[model samples]
Target chain A: MQEKNANQVRSRNEIFAERTSTKIYLEQASDDNPYIASAAVCHGYGVNEVMAKKSFADVFYLLFRGELPTPDEVQILQQLMIALINPGPRHPATRAAMNAGIGKTDPAHILPIGAALLGGEHQGGGIVDEAMRFLRKQQTTDAATSAAAHLESSTPIPGFGAYYGGIDILANKHAAQLAQLPGAGKALQWGMQMSRALEAQGVGWLMPGVAAAVLSDLGFQPRAGVCLYQLMGAPGVVAHGLEVANKPITAMPFVADEQYFIER
Target chain B: MPEKTFSDQQIIDSLNARRGKIISKTGGWFPGKGVFSHGYSMMDDLVGKKSYFQIVILNATGKMASAEFAHWVEVGYSCLSWPDPRIWCNQIGALAGGVRTSAIAATAMGVLATDSRTYGVYPLKEGVQFIQAALVNHQQGLSAEQIVASVPSRGGKPLIVGYIRPIAKGDERIRAMASIAEGYGFPMGPHLALAMAIERVLQEKYDEGMNVNGYVSAVMADHGFSPDEVYQIFTTLVASGVTACYLDTYHQPLDSFLPLRCDDIEYQGTAKRAVPTAE
Candidate 1:
């Protein structure tokens, strides 16, 4: 009687395990293609591969929030990014690991310590300090006067153009939204003046000064931009992980051949 | 004009009277070391007329560690010492309390030291905030009865407590501290840190015990400091009677034992200072 009962229990356990595994696999298969498609779209935008993942996260945030974040929210996001990027102050365990690894190692091999401890360069930690310097230089004076002084001083102006070329349509629209805010109209005007100055200097091909103006007027630290992108792309990593968990898909023959040559 | 002899009370009163003038001229809350020197000179006159009395120097020093009531024992000692005629001098440093307590402590101690109860020191705003945070934390988990029970009645005189930033010139800490100070509401005019450092060192040296003075003198002699320089440092230490002295060895020039002066200034927000006009 005891043996029969044990067999019945084993059968029930097997059924439960199978059901759980099946559910996970089905979920992974259903979401895997959509995640890839989203990643591909982000890649097309010229975002760095790591940032492409973040950009997808931003899309998720937008979809959830129903609008792009304001400058203040972006600043908060930047702080979060820094926390995500940097390791907590050195732990004794990590130090022990480092000490163990430290026998005549090349300094380049130690770069991972910084990479792991310091978040990616795209996170907005340092940018806030830089933006603050720029804002202070521009404060108190009218936008035109500030622009003129900034130009005279030969200070590098940020947010005056798109990253890759052509207009940054999103940034331009954001600037328009910022113009309606109190005390921001002047900033928008300054942005236009900066654009004209750049054009006069024969860099007319540069994108218009929208992002910088919006950021400054909103008191968004310059670091917020990278932070925003990082957050946007994070979902892509999750998506990729899901896809990888699905049945291992082999590439087409030519794609596999090309990859093999690239590796070589 | 005849040089008037002023007691500690008179000197403190003068400091109080000139507070506005000092701040406006120096662009800071506390007067420079030179101003303190002048006040000390006035103090000499009052001490000359009085019979020699034993003044115990209690140098209070500790990290602004946790907010426990026991943590403030040193602070309470300084406060308790204020009212005693025999314990005429006291110095407080690195205290973690709120702005109000710092102000109250400084004012109370200043009054006790000078025999005047209204002396005030304008510390950087950040320093004030730090003090306030400390006070708030200290007050937490305490009953009203416990607070009243903790009050010490002493030679019930007020003590003057001065806050000093002790970073050397051009050090990043100075800039960071200055920025924090500015955020708290007091901006350091140029060379404020240097002036504060010089004053703090002089004060600390003046307050040392007799044997400690001999030891310090010997150290100075071994280090090649002239007898007069040694004497000056000793007197300064005796006057300050501070428990802890932060010496900025990094940027301060070794040739002279003076703090460094740097040009870096940080404002509260991300703003930079306005461009300086060429001298």
Candidate 2:
């Protein structure tokens, strides 16, 4: 019987870490109490010193990359951050936030609810890692050749693909602009060429693709790229959510009964 | 160049069809009238008339499950509802409770965490897919040993999702669940038979046995559930366990769930240095 085998349910005896580890941030314990932190350091930079001397973009880049960005790097990062600040009112993530707010859900849940939906694969942060990996693997090759190879394939070229069956004009412009930056590297330039190659088929720069190109160039890991994509678009989702929060439930369309067709 | 348009008329038409309308095959509420779910009136036909699990399966799969099957599913849920916080999803709940977030938020987050590649609902789908595919392979004149060999291996062990348990060897839940299945008078169907044969091969060759996931997947497949339907039905499989974890920590002192000291974290990155001026 399987139940007899249950007696063999001994531990695998795997050795886990004695404590969690990180190099990102460190909170120095106070002299008085071991539990209390007296000082905080991010990548060896004193928090107070960073706050006084550095811009938010510089600190933000340092948080992930372990070093402060140069002027060109900071500029591109800041611009990309702004460009992706809001996924827009029509986006599903923003709409999720709006739905939560309009339904009078707890204000704290607004961000989480929207952010969770924003984690989807379609036009969301879910595909950012894949996009970043695609850009990294294909950046050294001919962009046009790589793009042509995927033209007939059913799967998208990851970061480089159509948005809503057409080119995302804003994303294309953002990629073009970022590529010209001094800090811009192979990923962004290759992506622009890939976008041009795909333009004939009405497929080009998606927002995630644009963010992936810049982030890959900036040396952010693919997984970090996913969270960063979500984080960058969060402000817009929260804003749209809060905008409709105080309004009545009627603020958003509920789809009339006649329009609510249940096929089954 | 002029703005490019979607050349696929089908996509445009599909979008246009639902532009201003909410077309649903599932049920919705009608104010002052009735709420419908899969052709049954929610209040009249479901409430107080059917078991909660039956309705849950109906809502998930668009097909009403038998009362016995629903009870079997409910028992399956019990097998998985371990209150141990060491499990990943439950740990999320514990962390949320430690931080004093609302219970709903903790449960929601934990449920979301279960949509993972590791030991959760997603893996359950993979388990079902594996067993169902293995059954097909068996019928096509493949022996159990051959079926086991077909699986991709990592580190010289088969990477079959349902067969091997993590953090333990044999599954105790399989015994408990099997007893319940017997009590419910479920026969050994083809899928379960194939699963057992494959388990024998694994036990003899690899010293690994089937986990509860394998048992449940085979039984569910035998009962005519598609992998996707089983996945949809078990969407909140870990919710109860997550809630239990939340309640355990919620009643405790703030930030007390697994408090770490400053030195507890091993910092392996850059050595301490002065912040450079902005470049």
TM-score of chain B of 2: 0.93
Q: Which candidate should be chosen as best, given TM-score against the real structure?
A: 2
Clashes of 2: 0
Lowest lDDT 10-residue stretch of candidate 1 chain A:
A20-29
Question: After aligning candidate 1 to the native by TM-score, how far in Å is the CA of B204 from where it should be?
Answer: 4.6
Could you give the fnat of all candidates in order? 0.00, 0.59
- Please provide TM-scores, in order, for all candidate models, with all chains considered together: 0.23, 0.94
Interface RMSD of each: 37.2, 2.6
Candidate 2 residue-wise lDDT, A48-153, digit = tens: 8899999999999999999988888899999999999999999999999999999999999999988887878889889999999999998679988888888876
lDDT of 1 by residue, A1-264 (tens): 011121111111222221112100011112544322222211122123324334443443333343334444444334333323322223222332243234322232233233322223222222333543454466556655655665678765544422222333333444444444544644555555554444433221111134334445545445554343333333332232233233323311112211221110
Name the Cα RMSD for model 1: 29.8
Q: Which ten residues in a row are the worst by lDDT in model 2 chain A?
A: A1-10
Where does candidate 2 clash, by residue pair?
A: none
Q: Tell me candidate 1's interface RMSD.
A: 37.2
